[model samples]
Target: MRLQTGANNQDKEEIKKIAEWILTVGEGTAEGNNDGATEIEIPNDVLIKSEKNHVKSIVSAIFPSIVEHLNDKGYFEDKAILVPTNEEVDSINEYVLSKIKADEHTHFSSDSVCQSEFIDEFEQALYAPEILNGFKVSGIPNHKLVLKEGVPVMLLRNIDQSNGLCNGTRLRITRLGKHVIEAEVISGNNIGYKTYIPRMKLIPSDKRIPFRFHRRQFPLVVYFAMTINKSQGQSLSTVGLYLQRPVFTHGQLYVAISRVKSKKGLKVLICDKDGKPKNTTTNVVYKEVLQKMKEDTTF
Candidate 1:
């Protein structure tokens, strides 16, 4: 944010050469009239590494030895690896989970296709338990949620309001029980707050799927890494921008880079089609949306 203008004097000329991408670093791209915001070089203060293996680079630089220091609030707090897609997020989380030298706890969800005209007994028969278990719908936990104690997860539903348990609320796993999970809130108004989460019936609102199904499972998702769009309201002190694929949506790159408190705390690794790291990546911006927003805010 301090370097929004991209202005540098002769004294700082040498430092300016280090930046390769002109990033519009500020309060996450929404605070001001960013009608046509553009940039070329990101400042050299942050660690910008170009590695072929982005997940490996991300883990090594951002969340190294996560199991050893899971109790450390600083380890998980205000620090995250940012990616382009939920698939990447899941893979990164699984990779991190695979490294933990602890007992594994796999929670299986009871998935059933709701009785409806859209799906009959024969169709339902096709959606076997194992087949339904393989389905990963948006905005719900997976059929087989494998977790370990001391892992971090985000609440997918508003379990409790007064207790600060809501959607997007982060929690650190304390005890992975057979029925319930014991976790402490690690972010928002409930930091260090202890609570229990029970299995709940969750139904996805994806209307495209003709048959409605309900998944009974813990309303949680691993928070080791999240998609760029999910990181909008989040403020992290240190962020590793893992561009496994370049962002496709409007302002995604802006939103991704702006998650960190400062450019100094941000690290970016841009990758090409072959997963080779590069210096520059695409930044999609909708000028019409920005212009409309500016017009709306004018009054």
Candidate 2:
């Protein structure tokens, strides 16, 4: 049985465009003038998306060789942005922080002030700290902020969409502060532009929790390695896709591979049963979804 994944309105629009493109191109029809025939120009966004997918496929094919070359040049760990599963984010972050002595620079402790009109002081004492500490241990905005200048970070909220300070936006910390931080946009159109990020109150949606609790913290995380879901919609100069376990969802492998700007910046490391480096990986694609897209052109 095939699972149905819901597509957003934008996705449906893109599908319609692709279907029309396919129908127009596959039928071998061209708009003709009196003197000559003119071929349809593909949309710039479509061309860029196609080019990125092509580069990703090529990079995935030669990932091992790319990893070897990167290691030889001593550019794997320090420079490249590592993308891994959520389970591995903490371990990798800890390893990278320790290697760089991130603690020596500056540490910003998140102010976890309990703010709720419903809960009293005694009740707040029981759930607020416990829940907030749990979030910290689980790497939700992190407990202790050990930041070093020039380290990569991922924005946790959509602070400014116009300036490209959105969720999952990658940046390098330029200056640390008590109430704010100066960071330069490392990816997207706003690259090299510096912006200020301030600590804000963030509330988690956990249905199991009986009381409401909000944690005041900077909406940023040390992104030495991030989850594939969080790495979506952002392209990196270099990507190291470290697979401790095989990806279990559709489009995850595709998302991870397509994060790099070029084939030269991509590397994949798969771990075997013994947790050693393996050369092969399993890629899961729901073929039925593609078939559905081809069958349904009404979008």
Candidate 3:
């Protein structure tokens, strides 16, 4: 389903900025050997949070489109769609469901299903393999390892080049001391002619599972616990960071604040006059959260 947007021009600007940032323009030259590999200790807490948030974001962004297409074809309100069981999810299941717009509106479930399932049903499409010639697609895009036998490697994917179509995707991963892999890249098709990610690091999460998508609306409650000290190194475009002295750390606060690309990307929660952590969290969106609170509380 096509998203009718009155703010096409505005969205184009935002998209352009996002693309540019991802491309890493004006970034430095590529560094280190082409073949490198190392294992870094995964911070259990950080991985848990990052993976969860990353997956949920991807799912929310992609699922709506799938649902919209399905609804347009009269799939919404259909009874044949499988409803995942609680048992299936706990022991051997990791399925999730949320309301979405297919063409009109519907519910989509991610249970006992593989990426191929979505593709088979035309719910989603993969980037043409040919377009990703230089990169390998032996497994799912994120599944393949970037290094082989302690050698650095690349993962290429099709990306929108500011100039025109690129030949392929190339992401360089080099081994650093302490079992770390520093990300670097050389690509003619997309952003950054040569960029050395000196501090870029990857810490595998438990099970080495890649992030998956989750689609849920706000007022939406997720059943997971969150802690602060676990977050470090990584940055986020948007985040709602919570802090409470003893349980929280300065390092976490710093990382959380830096994750956002700009001031518009952060939200902070502070205690109130009553000395209680007064649910005073605010997002650094275009509008102020305090104004929203006033409006929300006025009635």
Candidate 4:
């Protein structure tokens, strides 16, 4: 299911636009070599959405990857301004009512819109949006991409960078032996001009003590949710997207559907009023890529 921030996010028209933008802009280019062309297109008719359930597994793993890639690529170049509909207004009212119930000290009238507006005003007062673009995503590349028992698992380590600071390092769990797995750290933390490693004697699967820093040493692990806006700049090998109208922007629909390397790699779930995949627009670009891939791979 797609992530919704506020009640207004359930709009379908807006979701389609955002999805389109993602399809075109998110998967536009890549870092490595594979014909340094400006853009690439996959075949049409790849069955991006099926009547049956064939894309379940691939969807589970790919959504996170797609989100990370987009953040790396700087998809959130512009701000999204969302206007609420009547349905959204009602939702906000319901939410406000619930909040009022939770805090018995505050009294609220039956007017849902008034309560909702008051809550929105209070929340909006906290932080405004920051304008950002073209920032490299660190830490992700440090994690190793390896397989354990035929299942791929990304292994990461928390390493101490001098002066009470620690950065998590990562390695792939390559070959699992009786006690350890053969692995190597792909990336390490950089402090000032020097780079450091797990030089104190370490092996894969070894449970080491956490580094201490200034009475608190290591940096806390932080997780951030991926928004459709930030995901516009990535090129995903495979993608599973949730569509809703509330987060819509012009070209956003295009962005969401076109991230996959091929149509076969794309899976989309369109949520209805009941929060199920009952209402969804057919992804045109996904179909196009699928058709092309089949013809090329055909013997």
Top-lDDT structure, candidate number: 1
lDDT of 1 by residue, 1-299 (tens): 42323445752553343222334432123333344444333434564575556677778788767767977765686778888877888899999898888789999999987765476578868977788788887789999898988888989999889989988888889999999999989888769889989999998987877677889999999988888877878867778988767777778777777666545667877667887756656566667876788899999
Any runs in candidate 3 off by more than 4 Å, and if so which?
1-230, 243-246, 270-299
Question: lDDT of each structure?
Answer: 0.75, 0.57, 0.27, 0.31
Candidate 3, residue 31: Cα displacement in angstroms equals 42
Measured against the true structure, the TM-scores of the candidates, in listed sequence, are 0.84, 0.63, 0.21, 0.28
lDDT of 2: 0.57
In model 3, the number of clashes is: 15
Question: What clash pairs does model 2 have?
Answer: none
Ranking by lDDT: 1, 2, 4, 3
**Better candidate number, 2 or 4, judged by lDDT:** 2
Off by more than 4 A, model 2: 1-84, 101-126, 136-140, 205-211, 292-297
Candidate 4 lDDT by residue in tens digits, 1-299:
13122315456555454444443443332222222123223223332343443223223333334323332212211111111122332232233223222222111111111222233565443322221111112222111111222111222234434432233322322234433334333223321222222212222221241221111111111111133443454444445554433334333445555444444445554444444444334232334454566799996
Greater lDDT among 3 and 4 belongs to: 4
CA shift of 261, model 4, Å:
2.6
Superposed model 4: Cα runs more than 4 Å off? 1-58, 61-225, 244-246, 279-299
How many collisions per candidate?
6, 0, 15, 46
**lDDT computed for candidate 4:** 0.31
* Model 2 lDDT, residue 295, Cα: 87
